[model samples]
Target chain A: MILLEEVWRTFQVGEAEVGALKGISLAIRRGDHVALVGPSGSGKSTLLHILGCLDRPTRGRYLFEERDTGSLSELERSALRQSRIGFVFQFFHLLSRLTAAGNVELPMMFAGVAPEERRTRAQEALRSVGLAHRAKHRPDQLSGGERQRVAIARAVVMGPSLLLADEPTGNLDRASSREVMELLERMNADGLTLVVVTHDPDIARRARRVIRLSDGTMEEEAP
Target chain B: MRAPDLLRFAAGALSGHRLRTLLSVAGVGVGVAAVVSLTALGEGARQYVVNEFTSLGSNLLIVMPGRVETTGSIPFGGVTHDLTLEDFQALVGRIYLIRSAAPLAVGSETLRHGDLGRTIPILGTTASYAEVRHLEMASGSFLPRRDPEEAGNEIVLGTKVARELFGGENPLGKLVRMGVWRFRVVGVAAPKGRSLLGFDMDDAAFVPVRTVMQAFDRRTLFRILLEVRSRGEMEQAKREVVRLLAERHHTQDVTVITQDAVLSAFSAILNALTLALAGIAAISLAVAGVGIMNVMLVSVSERRAEVGLLKALGATDGQVLAAFLAEASLLTGAGGLAGLGAGLAAVKILTAVYPAFPASPPAWAVGASLAVSVLVGLTFGLWPAYRATRLDPVNALMRR
Candidate 1:
């Protein structure tokens, strides 16, 4: 479970101050699939980043599993992100030098998992994402869909409880986007909390709940 | 984190940019070669001088009346009116520590044979000069002690001087005019190569000291060369010589030096020169270090994205730093080894080509070169590695 109370995030662009998220309150229970929908510069990514513990809110209390995240040090935050959360980016930011299996094994490596277990886990994760055949192929050698699948496998390899995906299908075609969405829905069905940020109405409609934002303010929550 | 893995990684990275790595490594190689070759040249010269001095024999003492400067232009104070033939006689006849004493008197005189004439050195010594100075007779006999007592105008020519005067014919029993005196040729000494002063000892003619004194009308003695029994007795022998000479000449300002003492002083000077040359050569190593730093900075800039990916994959800043440092150290270390091998091979080639002068690379030179290379790696590597480690993961990830 994740909770944010009166989260106010601000940024400094040269001489002026800008508020990306203005006093937003939200909570999502464990196993819930949520979609954050907003226009460009509407603070959805900022909210997601805060939830992922990648950035701290300028003024707010963020609680993950009933523990306050604001009190954690940078190293503790990194460890929390490493062990408890997984991320999938819109651009499919897979490491260029690593093969599909290598990218999937990266999170487990950081967690200090045993080498044998890491390989087995990476293989299983790749299989789950339907990328087992492309395990030995580097990102440059794989198709865009396969590359996204490899990124997904890397994101979920650590078995994190929360999956934060930012426009996972933004760069994919309709067929690949459908396949990626099905993969995320299946993982959500397995009881992992999935929070996806996107501008597509069709993708937002598929989630169990949708939170809409407008100009740094939460507009409404719809089921 | 393991050494082999680090090495593999460095090898791969270096090979990825072959031209850059080679240029940097070549910089270090040239630096090392410069250091080794220049220092070896200096060492070779020093060795040549030491060998030249050693060939003159050891544990002997030279008694001169005045203070003699070992190097530079000859000073006027070296001339003294203290030493005489009586001092040499006293040491040979009275001093218990004396082994053998040879009274030496030297002057430049012109010798002529028919139309050919040349200025030749005339060394006047007794019959014991052959034994004390290790001179061997090449063809004719040496003058006897009785010859000097009888004031016989007899002389011995060196191998080169004999050839110059008599040509292909035998110079034994041939008469040559030396400074208005027709001296009989009693012997021809064996050919000895150039001395440390660059004077050819084989080009000089030797005659009895009494004959020179009587012929040249010279009363002042220049020096007395003494052969001691052993090096351990040099101090005792010198003290006795000084005491006997001071009593006869009635002057305490006399110079008596053992051969080993002179050699030690020469060694000290040569050691200082070697160090100075090595120090100058070390500057090249510093320049090579700057080359490494420059190349590494470029490498870090080119591999920004790769570095970002590594960091995102859980590599700590320290690991990134260590990786770059390892690359630099490996390059410099390899350069040092290659330079050392090249320098030793050069020494071998030189020795083979000129057997008279053999150069040996000292152990300290090798050790110092290795140390200098490592220091260069560290000094030049730190800044670039620090820059790579401090790059922002977000910004780096965003870089194409």
Candidate 2:
């Protein structure tokens, strides 16, 4: 569940203030499959960052599960992200030094899970992503599809309520992209709320809800 | 994170860049090694000097002929007046605390026996020189305290001088020629080891003070060595001796030095020298700390993606900061251990090469060196670790 009341984000570049998001308002209930589609410079990533609690809305209220997120301290926001929200970046963002299981276990490690349980749960998460056989592989050792799957396992290892993926399949080939998209869709079908930001038309069409942004504001939405 | 896991993660991070990590560690290692080894050398020199002085004798006082003055180019204020046998006799008789006093009259002589002859330092002192100097006799008896007229022809050879002049044969009662005078060797003194100050007890011969004064035709004694009854009586004995000498001679020209004063002064100078050595060595440690900071800064910039990934995995700013700091400490701690081994090995080699060199490392120096390395890690690591915490996860990830 997410709610925004005319949220605005502005950036200062040199001497001018650039509006990344201009008075945008939106809401999505739990278990919803939503796609935010936009061309370059349309503030898609910025909005995703705000939704994931990595950034605060510059002007306006952002309420998650009926609680005002803007009122929380930085520490509290980090804790909220730690326990309740997950993020998937376009480039996978897996630490190259860590194995697939190590990457998957990182979220639970920060959550203070015991080593034995972290191992077991990380293995389970990898299994769910169909990457159990490659649990020991590092990011560089894995294919693009496998790396994205590993990133997904890491995102969901903490059992967050919402998953925010920003162009998760951007670096993958078409076949690997289909596999990753299918995996995300299956996760959504299992009732974990999913919000995917993508410029791919196929991904936008498959989502239960599609929101299009032309500039900083939403131009249209298919309910 | 759990403590073990945190450490594991830090170790993993350091292991990622093997060469960089090793170079930084080597920097710290060299610093610690320099500090430990240099301080050990200073400490060893201090101990050596202390041992040398201690060997001179305990509760001993020397009455030099001149008073030390604070002002002027000359350190001693008074004119060079000769301390006589009467001054030595009077100190022994008047000062109740004076256990014994020996008059020293030193000169160089060509000591000869048969065809063998060598130039050696010869000491002219009373029979009390044996007890006052704590000198042991290796063979035969020491020169007896007889009427100065009767014992004028007796001399005691030092261990090495006796061996050089007489080979393995006993030199006791054998006649040895000194200058134009022939004297009987009454005893051979035990070997006292050489000192860095160039005083070697085994290399000199001792004769009766009257014999030296008569032989050299010198009326003045070189110095008066006073042995106190106990360490506690040294100050009182010195005051009494000085008072008696000045009162009788009507001149305050004598400088009285107790063993404690010399020992304390030497200890103070050497302590400061050791501290200075350690300070100079600590500069190298500071340079090593800069190296750690440099590498850590480079690592921070290079690992932006990893830092971003951690944050995206729900790590807080504090966690990221702690991770980097932990990584630094791990490097320095390992480096310190390696340095400890290296420094100790160097000390061992030095001691082995020079058997008499006391190259033992002090415990506090070792502990402080290790502690300082860890502290350097924490101090120099702060900037890079702080920078990691300030990274915006969204931007950092996007940069990747």
Leading candidate by TM-score:
2
Model 1: CA > 4 A from native: A1-10, A24-139, A147-221, B1-4, B58-60, B67-81, B89-101, B126-163, B167-173, B179-181, B184-203, B227-237, B247-251, B258-273, B342-355
What is the total number of backbone clashes in candidate 2?
A: 0
Please, what are the lDDT tens digits per residue for candidate 1 over residues B295-396?
Answer: 889988888866765555455566678889988888888778777777777878888898888467677888889888977887799899899988765446
Which CAPRI category fits model 2?
medium
In model 1, what lDDT does residue B78 have?
Answer: 30
| Structural similarity to truth (TM-score) of each candidate | 0.80, 0.87
Return the TM-score for candidate 2, rounded to 2 decimals. Answer: 0.87
Q: Which candidate wins on DockQ?
A: 2
What TM-score applies to chain A of candidate 1? 0.97
